[model samples]
Target: MPSTLRSSRDRPFLPKIKKSFTYHSTTNRGLTGMKSKGKMQGKALFYWSILLPALIVMLWLTLYPMITVFLTSFQNYNYISGRRSWIGLGNYKNILADQVFLTSFKNTIVYCFSTTFLEVLLGTVLALVFYGNFRGKSVFTILLILPMMLSTMVVSSVWKTLFHYDIGLLNTILSRIGLVRVGWLIDPHIALWSIVLVDVWQWTPFAFIVMQAGLLSIPQEVFEASVVDGASYQQRLLRITLPILKDQILLLCLLRTIDTFKVFAKVFALTGGGPGNATETTSLFVYREAFQYFNLGRSSAASMITLAAVVLMSIFYLRKMLNSKEA
Candidate 1:
């Protein structure tokens, strides 16, 4: 009877001990989870701290100026006079009606497209021709890329001398060949093309280097397999090469289009947007309006238009590139 009474007493204490153990385990698990979450939060805060300064700087430099220009574009502002009046698209209308702006827009479009096409075409051709290793290849490549290494101002100055009507190297060569001297920069009909030629000379090598790098990245086994499948040179180029190079070509076009559209240094140093505004580009037009005439409103309006066009082109190319990458 005594032993039975003792056993019942121990059973009651055993349940209490079991409940206490369960409570401690639950508390421990909760604490561990909370510590892990806190650690993750701390890491996140640390990363954000590292990135915040650069992000703020970028916004200040790029976004602030863009916003200021956008606001100025809608106002009739003059820097010298310190006057600003909200005209709400009056600046846009005035610039659009200006014949000089229209001509500049046309010239910019022409220059952008022509230079991009020619540079890409010539670069691809050169890359193809120089694909294989050969003697003096390095020397030749170094020589070809030398022009691109020079500053634009320097290149333009050199070309300006060469484009001179009299005692110019180019005209001298024409005379030696029994051909008449052509006015490269003085004639309105040929001045723009003369600038185009200078651009092609300086930038074609950049395109060549980009294309050659792309070509080199492609696996040789792919070409070897195509050859085994009875693919001729033209067949391989058309079916395989061009398709692979589509993205590179698109990127090249985007870069060249942006650079050529804002052609100022070459035009300024070579022809000074002269020969009757034949080579005047939008960049030069904005510069003249903003600095020369102190017409900040019109300059801002022109800048906005150029920005829109560049943004559209960039978006189109970027989307195509991203889609191609995904594919």
Candidate 2:
């Protein structure tokens, strides 16, 4: 009992020390909030720095060109002669009156619709066939995707040779089968279809891949439940599978439609819009007017028209897709 009092260091949990610590907790929280604000500001700066350059590039590459084309479409401009004059809607009128433009537009529509339909049908069927595991599935899938993997120009060149009217493999087989030696790329009636065939061969694989991805995403448990509930294979496919794949099919058609609508290289390589322009397309029409003839005004007008049509079609499909997504 000599010295009963304890030092503050040994009694740190005393009321006075506890009150002192509680008074400083607000300061600690204030420091933490300041640090968090500084970090958030730094992150915002970093993100803006990355996004600013991309936005500038997009303006230069896309926005500027689109604006220039829209303005030039109303002017009579000759690229080679460097002559430009305001012509109002003269270029559009002239193009609309041209039979060549009419034919090209018609051919584009036909190609877009026909190829999209066939590709969708074939892709859906093939995806279903290859949905389940099978023997040699890897090899078959690799072979199937090869056509889409190859360069478009190379594919066009190879198909051009194979579709030659004389001494081509296709013609040789047709002759062997006692079929007439048909003109694949030369006949006006069949030239467009020939290009379609080449496109189908090259791009059907893309559609097939898309459809297969959609098919494979379906849960196996869902299918098993359907089977256990007394659903037949066909019933499950129609009632369950097809309904789930509607969006994929629609998206595939949209992509194919856009690609086929702008067809140029195939027609240029295979037919050169020959046989009186059977395979002529809107893209080809625009290209020849701009480069070959140096008619920038008409070219711009034709391009604008084509763009408007594409925009309308895209709007329709995109609305459908968005609606489907919302549903």
Candidate 3:
């Protein structure tokens, strides 16, 4: 009450600070943005680290060789002299003009188509025969498939001897049966067909195996239902089995076509591309060009052409498969 004004010590003491304190919210946002950017950058770096090695390896192994072949195909490279000169399109032109190439091309198509058709047909029949349970079925299957298990070269050698004109088992059997002995391999007209027979014997079992797998995948319920509907065996097989196995059939066709197109070892072992180029294949021609004549450019061009054909064939099958899937 002595005075309305009080001393500073008597009232609440407040100190005056001199240091300036700035609250910058924008700085905090900037730090957060930097952290986010750092996290994003780290993740991107990790993905690149994982993928770079695989890409590098693929480039080195596959891409490098493909590039080399592509470049070499433009050059008339002599392997001994190592002399390289550009001869663009000359190899392709020569191959297209060569009568040997044309003949071999025809032979290849005929052989591939014939073998594929026969094998698939016979395979379907064999699959049907063995689909049901019977006595000694396992033994029969093993025995049937043993030919496919044998190497192509071995099978060819055995068949070469069997098809020998002079003293073959086949001729001997024909002689024993009082039938005229026929020349199997020596006859140019029949030599290619003889090779086809050997191929069919060896590969029919493969087709059978594939078809059987397709058959086994089918549900028994569908067959039971078909039976309830009084469908005949032929009707059920045609309507149900074949429809469901379409993909498998197409796949087998693709595989067999590709395999038979590249037929070489058998031809080499048996006919060596002919008694007259009657059984010559594109692969054998490529081999001769690449190795025997050292015409790398021509061989590469032929290989590319063959590859293009195969790729086209594969595309057709794949398109069918995709359409079936959609349906």
Indicate which candidate wins on TM-score. Answer: 1
lDDT agreement with native, every candidate: 0.86, 0.83, 0.81
TM-scores, all candidates, are: 0.85, 0.84, 0.79
Sort the predicted structures by TM-score, highest score first. Answer: 1, 2, 3
Model 1: clashing residue pairs?
none
Stretches of candidate 1 exceeding 4 Å from the true structure: 1-35, 321-327
* Candidate 1 lDDT tens digits, 237-282: 9999989877778878888988898899999999989888888899
Better model by lDDT, 2 or 3? 2
Off by over 4 Å in 2: 1-44, 317-327
Q: How many residue pairs of model 1 clash at the backbone? A: 0
For candidate 2, the per-residue lDDT at 226 reads 97
lDDT: which candidate is best?
1
Q: What's the C-alpha lDDT at position 168 in model 3?
A: 94
Which pairs clash in the backbone of model 2? none
TM-score of 3: 0.79
